[model samples]
Target: MGDWLSYAPSDFLLFSARTYYRLFELYNRAIWPAQILALLLGLVILWRLHRGGARQGLVVAAILSGGWLWTAWCYLLGHYDTINWAARYFAIGFVIEALLLIWTGVVRNRLSFQPYRDWTSRTGMGLVLFALVVQPFTGPLVGRDWRQAEIFGVTPDPTVLATLGVHLTVDKRPPWGLMIIPLIWCVLSGATLWTMGSPDAWVMPVVALGALGLAVYRLSSARGQSGIRHSEDS
Candidate 1:
């Protein structure tokens, strides 16, 4: 027990910071044009949201599920596992998340996209923008190589971030089931970066919290609206 107490989070890291960042560089090189396609897909989603229709939901959901599957395969099982054995477990989680999205969003067709034009939508968009654009610069801002930048569609962190953003934008109550994997990943990723002594360690966790707050508020507002409808019917 004393030995456990003596160890720190940094001590638990098996890879050096250089190795970790270089993984992204190798990964980016391996999957070149896919990043551009992913970014374009992200833009298409935002455009769909801006158009505001129930039909758009299917496209967005399917795209999101595909993105998760891609990350789970190409990034997690294929690449990340070589560096970190735990990535296999992480891949499992991502696979589950992808299936959930497919089942709920594609099959059941429960999700619909139309911004409520409130705090949830605004915050959600902010997250999406950050994932698509701002996140890449974060590593570079810290003097890390641009080749190491994590992109939205391909990388785990930004993919999760963008998914959470899209979840928050759902016309229905935020899907807590769908959110579970992403929320867990956010915390885990943040802590992992923190262990690596990375400056942007707080980013994912903070965004996770913000997404959670917006979800709660959206849920409460939903409940309130339901109550109002019930009263009016009575």
Candidate 2:
């Protein structure tokens, strides 16, 4: 019993590296031209952000919802659960995130995009570009085959990363609640990738923490400004 207690978390991984990469290849093949469409959606969102489009929030939310639902149904529940029992729980989290986006962005209209030329906005845009364009190539550049490449909207990690990027660009108060799942997923996926000894393992958690730190800074700055305005009025 004592010996069992000392086992590393990696010891419990349900799939081998070969099995994991094979799953990605199979999942990519199953999704086909949808990856192309996802790329197009990402481009459109990028353009909207650049122009400060009025309905940018709605569009971003709708696109993210689609990605999350597709990943939940097609990858997590449909394929991943065959090997890892925990995938079922991950699928549920993706579905919940999708629902939250729809409810807040579409129904309640609480989320909107108003871009500015601030460091945060530029950083967000840069992250979006990385997720949609650079990220897919990273796998191949690092020795993984094209078949094993993870595309935005088609896969979980890039989609989550890109979504976090969009949230960082919000001109007004950001939807912190909507960020919760992506933030958590980044940490979870980072740990999983670390266990697999993947080169990109550190990327997820680093981006997650960076975005979170920016959010905290922005919140503090806003509060300070608000307090000054109140004092002036008083």
Q: What is the lDDT of residue 154 in candidate 2?
A: 78
Give the distance in Å from residue 120's predicted Cα in candidate 2 to where it truly belongs: 1.3
TM-score of 2: 0.95
Per-residue lDDT tens digits for candidate 2, residues 1-234, read 999999987798988878988999998898888899999988987887787655877787888899999989999998899989999999999999999999987777677665565787678888898999999987888788899988899799999999999888877666799899999999999999899888888999999999999878777877898999999999
Tell me the lDDT of candidate 2: 0.87
Which residue pairs come into collision in candidate 1? none
| Model 1 lDDT-worst window of ten | 112-121
Against the true structure, candidate 1 has what lDDT? 0.89
Q: Give each model's whole-structure lDDT.
A: 0.89, 0.87
Model 1: per-residue lDDT, tens digit, 120-189?
8877977888888899899999999989999987999999999999888887688899999999999999
